[model samples]
Target: MTVTTDTARLPLLLTTLLLPTVARLWPAIGATADAEGWPAAKTLATLLEHEVAERASRRIQRHLIEARLPSGKTLDTFDFAAVPMVSRARIAALAEGDSWLAKGTNILCFGPPGVGKTHLSSALGHALIDAGYRVLFTRTTDLVQHLQTARQELKLASAIEKLDKYHLLVLDDLSYVQKSQAETSVLFELISARYERRSLFITANQPFGAWDSVFPDPAMTVAAIDRLVHHAIILEMNTDSYRRKSAQARAVTSDPGTTAHPN
Candidate 1:
């Protein structure tokens, strides 16, 4: 069955196979590419542009959805009206590119749990990612544990280097547990190495005064906080727990078909 010399349709066949690669942007320039006959150079250029746009869109979605905020709320969805009136200058300062955000300035977010601390930091992280900055989100406990494990494997410096690649790093739940002596020392090293190289966003339930209890060593704790707070915008979230309202809303609207647990 070695039939047919339809060289006329060879280019059209190629375009059909490549159209699916730009499926998201179909019917615009993609549809033009799929039409019969050898495609003009402009059509190929359009396909390339479509592919680039699709890739960027996918990356943006990954950055937004993979953002690890357990509260299931986002900055846009949160009630900023309840947000405290801080200095307008501080808010504006975040928009600027300084050695801190560029070189990775350490940012410390401290307040009680459920006061939108994580939300704000995560939002800032999201914005940074959108602005073409590499960002990573992790819980402080998990980060410290990873560092400990890396030390056991004698790869701590390499692990820290991996983390340092991100332009912005967000660590949530800083008050969950106090760092061990070794963990604290490793954390100090991370703070020093990234002192002005990369920016860090940390959400903590404890205030700066009680931070010594977490680090335990007065001098190192002060140094860590000092590096973190330099040129940082401290947003003290003093609002009541929005989680309570969300929980109450869920309780009132719970499924009628579900039975309550019996004692």
Candidate 2:
């Protein structure tokens, strides 16, 4: 339908002039308004909302790509039943809206190897990315080495400043870092710099006492723990290895070379 009258053409003209960037939407907006008999106000509102959502989706995709998050993990795919002690409700809230990271609250996940710590952390991070939060994932040793290199070049502060851009920094397998002053010093500096400004989501195979093996010096170890636990959420993953359990189930379900078990 043609807008022959000046009264009807005024709103459409204004919409195009105001949203020149989304001029492609003008045709659909006019078509929708004509077909649905919608008021200009309603049509403009709907098209504007659609434009905002599309832009948000594009931004989220970019964040995910840059995040380098562990793939193929989400709350839906996690076997919460296997780990009964974990608080599913709490995790869901944090992933969706807790915004604990916004207040510089750290998250510490402690458990033996294969207990799904990485999986849980990665899944939560994926959720946060979808929720418009920036996340960066790195292994404990790699990030420490990177920091140490930055220190060598006298660019440690600059490196840390770059990292501060992310809302949450996920360090996987903190127990693997060797007890070396060079490594620990840089790591400590990172923690100290972001102490009350950014968040850390860390996974460790060892408990707090065992962390001394990673830090060596008792004072530095204590300081690291203090900063981490202050205003933090501690998740103790005490369950057995999910990978082991899955392997055991597969063995039981598999055939044993045509041999039948006696009933």
Q: Tens digits of per-residue lDDT for model 1 on 139-254?
A: 88888888888888999999999876677778888777585535556777777778777777888888888788667489988998888887575667766776776776687689
List clash counts for every candidate, in order.
8, 0
lDDT per residue, candidate 2, 161-196, as tens digits? 999889999999999998764557778778888897
- Model 2 RMSD in angstroms: 4.4
Runs in model 1 deviating more than 4 A are 1-41, 61-72, 86-100, 180-182, 245-263
TM-score to true structure, per model = 0.72, 0.86
lDDT of each: 0.69, 0.85
Pairs in steric clash, model 1: 100-105, 103-197, 103-198, 104-197, 104-198, 104-199, 105-198, 105-199
Instruction: In angstroms, give how far residue 94 of model 2 lies from its true place.
Output: 1.4
